[model samples]
Target: MGACDRNCGLLSGAIIGAVLAILGGALIPIGDFLINKTIRKEAAIENGTIAYENWVVPGSPVFRQFFFYHVQNPSEVMNGSRPNLKQIGPYTYRMRYLPKENITQHSDYTVSYFLPNIARFEPDMSVGSENDTFTCINLAVVAAPAMYKSGLVQIFINTLIKSSNSLMLQNRTVKEILWGYVDPFLKKIPFPMERTIGAFYPYNGTTDGLYRVFNGIDDISKTALISSYKNKSTLSLWDGYCDIVNGTDGASFPPFVKKNHVLQFFSSDICRSIFGVFKEERIVKDIPVYRFVVPPAAFASPLVNPDNICFCTEKVLSRNCTSAGALDISACKEGKPVYVTLPHFLFASKDITENIEGLYPDMNEHETFLDVEPTTGFTIHFAKKLQVNLLVTPSSRIETLSKIRQPYLFPVLWLNETAIIGEDKAEMFRSKVSTPIKMLHLLEAVLIIVGAVMFLGFMVSYFICRSKKLK
Candidate 1:
């Protein structure tokens, strides 16, 4: 071949290679930076945005399963014997949140709104009907004496209980036990007391409080985080730092989640903020997620987790503080002796679990966890499991409670509230969020590799042509 032709070929190859290399090198980081910035902007809470629409009304279906504990030997339990308990039906319900109410935008890049909760029983999803009966402790009978301090009031309550033939244990339908039932004794009483009693009596068709959350206009990292609840930044129920409500509402989180970062959210049902730590990576419905779990130390005793000391109240501290894995929520539950723990007492103290006969803690089934998509900070799959227990102690002042027994943390019922991203939403997420990110990464890699090969070929050809001309 002619020297001029060979030299021209080398020059053309070098120019093409240099151009490709420059484009590849410049686009990779710039494209990534721009895409991430766009995501952050889209994730911000603003009117008419996708994030705002989903926040106002979530598209996922939320299911709430209630597992009631039935007492097999109620008489034996009153006489200081360990309660032989049996886990009954899981009466599942489909829960939905209503549209946001009284939405207001503040000057500080925050939005305030109220979201109500509504639940409907799903017979197909449940093991049995809500009409099924179970032998359960009468909460009013056990809690009356502890609620009132006056001796005269206690005597009157005791007399009313006797007159109404109220027993420590009574047969109640699942609906009555969970929703609300008009107690005969409670109706007859004159004091200001709730005549209707149930585990979730006040929750149905109710809003927890007015919520104010950050809109991410000023700071993207603080998006969707709760600024205040019920017009207050702290709760009066808990002490010290426990009173401070610090977290998101669990609907959405800030973008770009890290592996070691703790995910926190405030649950109105539990009346406090809880956090989850990274457990592992998970793949769900062709989507990658970061599985964050409630660490065992979250409800650990003050000895194990000094940060939890503020959770203990004066009454709980007087009794040497609550044991490991038990949270004394009496302050939040209208002064009732109510405590919450993991399902089957998964991480509870040995003494608490040993007192019951039927409990079998299993981490796979009982643990609470959140599977979040790290890029968008969306919780794609999550299950929040919690068991409610009543602290039953023998009261000498009340006749019905004058049983030969010690205090027992009676297992009442447990609930598992779960939700997963629907197929339609998941598909949309893949198309919009996951696919774009993946394509960007794939393009970046391909460009770099192809550009490097072309540049190398150009260098080899240019050197060979120059050597031939010199020869």
Candidate 2:
């Protein structure tokens, strides 16, 4: 064959190989990352040793390695925060994992500190004089993914890398480093007095066991917490601390949970374990739980014209205190003492569902409702292109903030509003519009016809040339 024909054959073979490689690459899968342990021992004098329990998947080979690294290493875990940890080892380290989906918003991630495993080693002073005890070390592990909704693996690795870098370069105390970025590091904690806040997901399901509500509120704002802390002196001594009156004689937590230090909590399996420990210790504190009154549904009414939901935010400085704007507490329940007040904003939805259900599936079906006629509130609209029918019910309970001596009010708002656009479509189960069968068939048909014509032309051209040569 000539040069042109030879090049064409080679090009076709290369294309076929490339296509096969692409197909093979798409079919295979890989396993999760592995953590390998390099060295683990007691700290020599001032040197540190880390001992961590398995933290990864139970049966994975790297589980032990993860335990060691988890306690010894500091990891970057937030959007803008660094992975800075303090090394005070010679203790046992424990670890827990939060699936990427568990925390969907910035408010879901928070700062956590705990005692981990221990490390012990003997000191060698002067040969046979006497081997005394040297440095003892204790370490804890904290890992959080930067993004919860997507980019999970990348985020986790990035956090680990940042934490490792910080550990190598910075020498500050863990407390100082953590406190420096406290505002963003800690998730917006709800009022400590409530049993549960609206932020928790699967509130009534099995996963719900991981969470407890000493004081729970729905859709609270962050501005409230900061304002309250600033005006702590002007406020009651119990302003920052949640006041729980134990009707069961005295109040005590599990032995593991230190009573003196402040703790921030979340809905995780770890909470379940802690609660189990509390139950084993027989520590049940009976405190009053009062619910907070929800804002008018008008705030969540939909904007039909714009196809968008809106929110209204306001900042008002505390009048009789030095704190910033405090949440409007007038809407809290009555006949109950206010035990604890966490700063939270009152949010009204422009849409019937608040569109929050997509990320926070924990919405109380009953609490989400439409306000109409007797209720006299704003209307909630679905998307602008779609008009939907809605259902609503009114709640008879009137929530009050305080009943003179009441410390906290946790009102259970279960009202709900569901949109009914129309009857189900007959083709609801049909395939999406993007299916490629029709296009594929059309292209194939065209190619076949073109190929036939080209073949015929080639044959005819050959015959004509042969006849001319004969002439």
lDDT (Cα atoms) of all candidates against the true structure: 0.84, 0.20
Question: Lowest-lDDT window of 10 residues in candidate 1?
Answer: 313-322
The candidate scoring highest on TM-score is 1
TM-score of each: 0.91, 0.16
Off by more than 4 A, model 1:
1-25, 150-152, 314-318, 453-471
- Model 1 TM-score is 0.91
Model 1 Cα displacement at 201 (Å)?
A: 1.1
Best by lDDT: 1
| lDDT against true structure, model 2 | 0.20
Clashing pairs in 1: none
User: How displaced is residue 298 in candidate 1, in Å?
Assistant: 1.1
Please give, for residues 1-471, the per-residue lDDT of candidate 2 as tens digits: 764555455455445544444433332221001111111011000112111111111111100000001111222212112212222221211111222112111232211122122211112311111121211111111111111214554344335434443211122222222112222212222334222211111122122111111110111111001111111212221121221211100011111122222212111211100011010111001111111122222222223211112111111212222221112221121211111111111232222223112111222311222211010000111100100110111111111101112111111111111221111211210111112222433444555455455545554555555566569
